[model samples]
Target: MIVIIDNYDSFTFNIVQTLAAAPPGAPADWQQPDIRVFRNNKITVQEIADMAPDRLLISPGPCTPKEAGISVEAIQYFSGKIPILGVCLGHQSIGEAFGGKVIRAGRVMHGKTSPMHHDNRGVFFGLDNPFAGMRYHSLVVEEATLPDCFEATAHTDQAGWL
Candidate 1:
């Protein structure tokens, strides 16, 4: 099962839809994991522990990590123990949890698409180089502030690696 910690972001439903959509021509043996979403404001660590998910996904939100009411310590506790994927605000939370910094971009981007350059590794695996991706963010991660353990896998000319 996969547990999604939602922060009431506008893109929450879209994220879930994208994940739930099965790829065309997937092997018959392929199986989608059972997914459950918990609101950040209402969920507790005990509830998460009870779910025993194979992975955790942090959903994007309008607020910063601090304002989102997610506990950084909790995220750190689950970091290496279970696979975690963060999107947008959630991604920022992961960085901040690891001593990274977040900042406002000079130009806010919304519903724009850009060519993404990637190392073709990890999450970028199987994706084409310079893949076209949508962008909808005002704040970004400072690459220089990333921890030594984390390396950028994708970036665009408009936004460095945020």
Candidate 2:
């Protein structure tokens, strides 16, 4: 099952709606696209894993990565054992979780549809061209911190890859 993890320190209507709108389809191809909110600053990754999600998708939240006190070590613990998708902090967590570094980008990228570069296998599967996607983050992955197992499937001047 694809579990869309609510990374928020708290739960909100948007997070609920995102999950309600898109529930997992099947065990083999299940994916939770909804934005579940942790709603509480005390929430932990182990608590998230308890939900029995086959894969994990980190969603945006009120807490910043640094303020949230998220440990890459915790995320690393859940690495290849399960499929993980990091959105804003989610993406950053994935990088940091797996020995990659994350830093604030020189500039901010906001809005829909931006130019991106793909290495080999893009983030969004089946799309061949530069993809149009949502953006709402201030940090970017450090090139030096990127892992060999990961590839830059999509990119923008502000943030690269999903």
Candidate 3:
């Protein structure tokens, strides 16, 4: 089962819809990908983990939860044991969770497709080399802060790191 952990209500719906609409044999076509959407908002990390199904997909949100009164630590602790796919916010959080740093970009960029530096191997399957993908984020990651487990799969001068 593949689980998508996020506070956004639409996160699961979007994933479910995309999988249903994917071409035959697409990665998301989950013959029965048990997709579980978790809302850790206003809840404890233990409670969130208890509800987790399997693979985790962390979605993007505010630059930092402090403004929203949310701590990434709790969620990170729970996701530590599970396979996780960090999206925009998810990516930043993953880095932050592992002693990485995140900061707001001087400018805001939102669109489909941006070049990325693939320092890690086999991160973007099917791609000949490192390239761009959809991006809708205002915060960027600090390379030095990222843990060794993560590779700068994609990046752009404007976005700093991805």
Candidate 4:
């Protein structure tokens, strides 16, 4: 099962819905796994422990980690227990949880598109090197603030990371 922790972002519901949907004419191997969505305010580590999900996906939100009221307890509880995929704000949360910093972008990047330069590693595996992606963020993670274990695998001309 895949557990998605929703951050109450405007895009959260849509993203979850899309992930839950099955593609038309999908192959037999394209199995739709069981998925669960929980709002950040209501979700707890105990619930996550009970679910025993194969992976956890942290959805993006409109504010910083501090503003979102994401507790360090939750981060600590989930870290290293399961595979995690953090989107936008959630990505920032992961960085902040590991003693990294978040900063206001030089320019707001709402509804913008950019060519992403990727090393084609990890999550970038099998993806095109210079793929186009939409940007809708006002803040960014400080590359220098990231732990040595992490690397900036992808970047864009406008946004340093995506």
| TM-score of each candidate structure, all chains considered together | 0.85, 0.65, 0.68, 0.81
Find the candidate with the highest TM-score and give its number: 1
- lDDT, model 2, position 13: 47
Candidate 2, 2-62: lDDT as tens digits: 4455555343345445434433232323244433444324557677678665555566665
Error of 4 at 36 (Å): 0.9
The alpha-carbon RMSD values of the candidates against the true structure, listed in the order shown, are 2.5, 4.6, 4.0, 3.3
- Candidate 3 to native Cα RMSD, angstroms: 4.0
**Per-residue C-alpha lDDT of model 4 across residues 1-162, encoded as one tens digit per residue:** 777777888787776676566455544332576788787878787877897887777788877887654434456677888667678888888878888888988888899888999986544655667988788888877888877866567889865765
Local lDDT at 140 for model 2: 73
Model 3: per-residue Cα lDDT at residue 148: 74
Instruction: Give the candidates in order of TM-score, highest first.
Output: 1, 4, 3, 2
In order, candidate lDDTs are 0.77, 0.57, 0.59, 0.74
> Which window of ten consecutive residues has the lowest lDDT sum in model 4?
22-31
In model 1, the runs with Cα more than 4 Å from the true position are: 24-30, 119-127
Better-scoring candidate (lDDT), 2 or 4: 4
- Candidate 1 lDDT tens digits, 1-162: 777888887688887776666455543322464778888878886678787777778888888888766545547868888877788888888889998888897788898899999986544555679899988889877778887887667778877874
Q: lDDT tens digits, residues 1-162, model 3?
A: 555556453454665666445344346534556665555465555665677555666665554643322336554675557666667677766777777777776676777476665554323544545566666767766777766776455566555656
Q: Per-residue error at 100 for model 1, in Å?
A: 1.2
